[model samples]
Target chain A: MTMARRLRTKDLSAGYDSRVILKDISLEVPAGRITAIVGGNASGKSTLLRTLARILKPKGGSVLLDDNVIHDMPSNAVARIMGLLPQSPIAPEGITVADLVGRGRHPHHGLFSRWNAADDRAVTDALTATGIAGLAERDLDTLSGGQRQRAWIAMALAQQTDLLLLDEPTTFLDVAHQIDVLDLLVDMNLSRRTTVVMVLHDLNLAVRYADHLIAVAQGGIHCQGTPADVLTEATVKTVFGLDCRIVTDPVSGTSTMVPIGRHKSGSVGQEAQSRK
Target chain B: MTLIIDTQAAAPASHARNRGTRRAVIVLNMLGLCLVGLIALTLSCGQGCLPPAHVLAALTGADAGGADFVVNDLRLPRALMSLVVGLCFGLGGAAFQVMLRNPLASPDIIGISAGAGAAAVFAIVVLSLEGWAVSAVAVSAGLGIATLIWGLSSGRGAAGARLILVGIGVSAMLNSVTSYLLLDAPAWDRAEAMRWLTGSMNGAQLVQVWPVVAALAVFGGLLAVSARDLDLLRLGDDAARALGVRSDATRFRVTLAAVGLVAFATSAAGPVAFVAFLSGPIAARLTRGGRFILPAAGLIGAILVLAGDYAGQFMLPARLPVGVVTGAIGAPFLLLLIVKANRNGGTL
Candidate 1:
């Protein structure tokens, strides 16, 4: 049987208890493309990501994974087709990197199935892919922030799903580490044709990395399309309330945003050009 | 860069060695401690007058004289009861610790055992009951208390910390009731009440051992099967769900099995101090990895009870009961863990 690669949400309304964070949101993640959801804080981007990942129950409408209603499907069946990494993934104390990664293979085995060589190889390959093979035996708590994030990504990768969702995967990293994480995600997309949906706080990074940009505002999609079309200066002002100049990145030829503050409207673009 | 490359090359080799050695150490410790505990039980059996050799002979049914009567009628039943009670406490405690993600969340501390204690005390002091009747009441009370705690803490997103808080409050209230009953009891009932209050394994009959064995076979098997789900739970709710774990259902079933195990254990042996509280952390420490180690904790719990009973019998000059000895040792450790947990701001 052929598996469906498309993930779409239909007018989904969800929240914690009575407070609805995401309202009447409809979105379809382009198959085999990197989709980045960007918005201000409390703009429902994370909630939308979580709802799409099936971690949060939608009060209205449904998330359709390849045409099947996700809420009706068994979670293990959904898990086999998709994976999610939360904003901050926690590792139980003293868990080795390899052991943590191996847990990702949960959907493949039943209650009594022994851990076979295929599971072992998948874990090893995930560790190697995330460049944490050397840290396989190291305790998770002992790793640096970037390495730890990679380990978590490795776990998601070991799921070997067609679609992967991440909420702020690079929130706590340094600039270099942020680029490293984005590059890894790009590599995963390019090499494996994995549909990646992520919420990113950095507008420029989102434009640079995402094949499709979803600008969220007021608990709804403000703009959605290719970065060049969706992330214009006016949309940035409307979505983030930040007046900004849009320019093409010298290296990636993607749209980049430069914020024009109250006093430095004309100098921002010059500064960015000089830095390049 | 050079150092990074070199260390990376050598890490997996040392890591493999480290894992192998740690595993070997855990196995050796479990086996060795069990042997020591069994030997201690045998030695403590002959404390009245007979020698250790005579106790051993009696145990084997070789010396079917006075030694046989003491060993079979008194020592053997007590020892077997201790073992079974310890297993139940260990498995139940380990399950709570893993499920709640806190070492301090044992059935003893969380009032499940206290419910059993309160009921048993009520039966013995107020109703003038003894033996199986008290045991039956204790078991039912334990289940009731667990249900109460679950009901109280089953709010939206009622995670480990909230459950622990509710449990602690319920336990404290139940403890007060138990104390009041003990104080109001007649002088004749005070001795039995005191033994029960402090968790004694004295005068353990063959009948007490059977119910616990049966409980362990049922509840212990359930807990063992659900062990993986408990491990998944430690990764927090969202991650567990993402990995296809039905968190709510798994939590419910595991809690029921664990509560049953603790209730049976408490009815069989008294609350028995902190065997449930201490076993999981002790097993985790001994194993030295992040594995849950439920079976290892169970073995450790069994060994601790047997050893604690033996220590109470022979180590102290006054010959205190098993519960008193365990309480004395475990209370300080509990305090230490509380302080450590607060300092780390990890889990309660």
Candidate 2:
């Protein structure tokens, strides 16, 4: 396995033209671990991830990979060490799962080089690891939502990078499939020692699966630590701006935030308050 | 768990890829055969109607007497012009369509051809310019118009849709300028200017073929080098960038190459109507959106112009320009596409 590459942002400010979404922020992604960025809508979660992936140019400051400025480094060289799966990537019409995954070898080959055995091996390994080898010949348009997401993940896996970044990898899936994808990501992190960083919408899943959590709010990092340290009643209120009770998840033995809404059963709320 | 690096495990994926490659190869070979047959037929069946044998003998520099002048001087240039101009249009058109991720965003559909055509007409009718000067003006105007459309349509939401819409508007305005120039010109000049407007192969010369061929060599080579990066851009900007494609750089190279092709071809053959617009979708259908889209589209473009020019010259009641025949075919297809897009509520 390749050594896990260091990815960190030093006072990074990034956004679209003339609009700064993420203010001056400093953070480091732990190597060989899973880090999840969780935030409310338009809270700069994606901006942070994009800047880290070097998709969006930073307005100020820099993202450093292995002590070298990432944006200034040659893109292909950076891509050989790091891979990313953006939210809602468009698959060309009628593309097969294998062909899409094979495209991940782009960074490995020069302009005139042919696909070699190592590329085939990486693609094969990625397919097997993601459990999509059987669907290699299947058109992406024919796959189920969960299967399509897996195929996309398989593409990133085929890149053979030490660090992988994903933006909301489980956005539109059902609860079961969401867990399934998260489990697959965890499996990758464990088996390959690939540093995994992702933006996730589900707070409970982020707390359960991620080794480290970064809660973003109002364009900057509100808190960063292990899940146990980051998930709290006050943190939920501050980050998501919702009244919620932090409860111990029985299945995962992690902190789960259950939002307290006006229409909730009064008896249940009172029982939760009493327990607290 | 032990890692499985078995070569056998990759068989199914490689097999699928090989199948796609095989399909593309077979289709391209068939298109090549058709192009050969059309070129032969074109050389043989005009005016005095020489036999294939006589045409072949003339082509091979044998003494076929009168057939030599007819084949070598008359039909050869026209045939060669059709081939190169068609290729330029087809390759340029597909490049734009793929880059924009919209089938409706071809150079002719969007304003590049009109930009070139309008400039050529102005040079010929108003300035009384001839030859290279007209072509030079046309090429510069095409590039300028493409840049203008690109700049205007970029910013917030749905840049592809906005660009196509803006291009259509610009094309209309430029076309009207061409018509106005034609209307005010002297009668003799009007006929000459009409070739630029409707795209004629009427007076094609051997000298005219070389410039477009040279343009094809340079610009086509550029497109070929940038082909894979252009393919990745189909996945959208962010995803392509993540895959290490410098999206902006790739887009610039592709745009320059494609615009160069359109302008050069337009200068030579007057845009050739819908050859550029029609080639990509046809080739995509034939190749099933395979890896050889660019080359296959160029072949299809060549075939369209050759076949259309033949039909216009012989099969039709009146001797129409190649563009007229293709325009007749393309306009209805355009309507059908619009109807289909509307029915599906797709962003065409």
Candidate of highest DockQ: 2
Residue A56 in model 1: lDDT:
86
In order, what DockQ does each candidate have? 0.46, 0.65
lDDT of 1 by residue, B1-348 (tens): 999986665455335435745784666476557756585555445567567777778778795567788777888888888888888888898888877778877899989989988888788778988766876788788878877887888864355667788989999899888889888876845446656677778778898788889889998888877777778878888888899888888887788788888877776677889999988888777665455468778888888888888888878887778888888889999999989888885542
Q: List the residue pairs that clash in candidate 2.
A: none
lDDT by residue for model 2 over A1-276, one digit each (tens)?
A: 769688999999999999998888999999999999999999999989999999989999999999999999999998899999999898887778988998899999899999888887888889889899989988888999999999999999999999999999998999989999999999999999999999999999999999999999998999999999999989998999877878899998988988886556477666656655
Task: List the lowest-lDDT window of 10 residues for candidate 1 chain B.
Answer: B9-18
What's the TM for model 2? 0.96
Model 2: residue A225 alpha-carbon error in angstroms:
0.4
- Model 2 chain B is weakest, by summed lDDT over 10 consecutive residues, at B1-10
